[model samples]
Target: MTQPSPLSDRRVVLAVAVLCCFLWGSAVPALKIGYGVFGIVPSDTATLLLFAGVRFSLAGALLLGYALATGKPVGLDRRTLGRVSLLGLVSTAGQYLFYYVGLAHSTGVKTSITTSSSTFFSAILAHWLYTNDKLTGRRLVGCLLGFAGVVAVNLSGAGLDLAFSVLGEGFILIAALLFSLGGIYGKRVSGQLDVMVMTGWQLGLGGLMLAVAGLATGGHLGGFGWEGVLLLAYLAALSSAAFALWALLLKHNPVGSVAIFNCLIPVFGVSLSGLVLGESFLEWKNLVALALVSVGIWLATARKDSVVGRPSP
Candidate 1:
């Protein structure tokens, strides 16, 4: 097979990655609506877990249905099942469970800013784990650029207090760690299974786990108003659709390098939140923070052989 030129491959991956960011970013504002509209009046943790449960369960079921109708062979072998299970737990279940809860405690902008730190966190963990994909000099420069945007969005203006919300930040940090774990496990199990089938298994199992957690926490399930239903559909469709695309990209492209696209989440998420949720957009500190995150993303993922900062060259 004469491989297609690298430029074409990069273009495809970049397009998919940006789409994923857009979907996820768009979902954040919808999520705020979900929290407000849902009738299950649980505390923050249970409420967030409930949202994760509903979203993942809907996504998982839809994927499974698609796989079955298409004859995609969705079940995993024993060993692969274990690996996928772990990946589901770390990447999807753990990460978003924490993320939703954190969102309740912080503003959309703050949560988005905190999430950008995932690249920094992943780089450190990927390095410590002796992961083969070491950060290149250009990648570092890009990540630092991205991190600068993070700082500008988080703490670079007069109204922005320097006081760190450890609780909010800590949840996102954990989400980042879980994301790294998923990527690490992906390195091991990726080639062994069909990507779509693997995604079905991961989403299905992760959805189950989140549902169980929601049950354990006594998540309330009521209030089927139009707004609630709309938010639910939004979370399930937008977030999960994008995630499926993301999983496909990870399957076909460079894993660690692809992870850098996560930095775009804050950029998209914050902007969408401002427009849709009436979140503020004019803060000078936020501009600086955004710039820092953009820089950090650049430092975190820039490469020498590419015109754009994508996983492929």
Candidate 2:
């Protein structure tokens, strides 16, 4: 029997990347439901921070617990700890702070589309940061196609609009940039530390910072019932699983190769939002968007000539 290829195998990498994006996509609807259950309003910045803080803190704890339980070494040197803390601050806390605030100011459709810009940011940054991941015609086209699909989906109910606000669309774009930068930095850090351990520590430290900030700003969670607790736990679990898997993928593959899958997050978000919240999902544009995204992924990842950032077997 042919043995299964390692996780870094192109096929395996693609599968895991898609899975990670799917989990992240689910978070859109889940967060909306969470806001309702927790009695959070779009204007409640403090409460939003608190909710995000608690979810990430718990996610970090769970990841750390899993690493220890699975016999993975959990040791972190001082430098590593500092690096992880920075990663957490920028990646988890800062990104979400901007995202929540941005979402509050902007429409959901706009937020979804703008946040997808992280794929382009990641691709551009990787080209500058890593020699092997230089920008190529295929990668550029793939990214453009994926971005077009994102725009297409958002155009279903509302046609394209040029309405812009600094705090609204601008912050979302900033969050996307921070997220992309953090991913690149994390890729560099992963060369030295265990990806799981790194993810756990960064999340823990970042979540703690967010918690402190939220509390200082008088953030409060209204619902403390079983439903609230269950939703919180689910969000935490999703973060743990998605981040850990993503870290692993970044460690093994080119940044652009892995980051392209992020296009699917918006696609999945729209579909899941429809299913969970009973929103309309039958638009022809949705189908076209998904098709474009699929083609984009294929074009970006199917190149055998491109140099993957990982060391050769």
If scored against the real structure, what TM-score would every candidate get?
0.82, 0.95
What lDDT does each candidate get?
0.67, 0.87
Candidate 2 residue lDDT tens string, 108-135:
8889889999999999988877767867
Q: Taking the tens digit of each residue's C-alpha lDDT, what string does model 1 give over 162-263?
A: 345656667766776777667656644655876656666677678778878877987766768887777777777775577677766655544545667777
Superposed model 1: Cα runs more than 4 Å off: 1-8, 40-43, 100-110, 125-132, 155-167, 282-313
Q: Give the C-alpha lDDT of model 2.
A: 0.87
TM-score of 1: 0.82
Error of 2 at 207 (Å): 1.1
RMSD of 1: 4.2
Name the 10 consecutive residues with the lowest summed lDDT in model 1.
304-313
Worst 10 residues of 2 by lDDT: 304-313
Best-performing candidate as measured by lDDT:
2
| Alpha-carbon runs more than 4 Å astray in model 2 | 1-5, 305-313
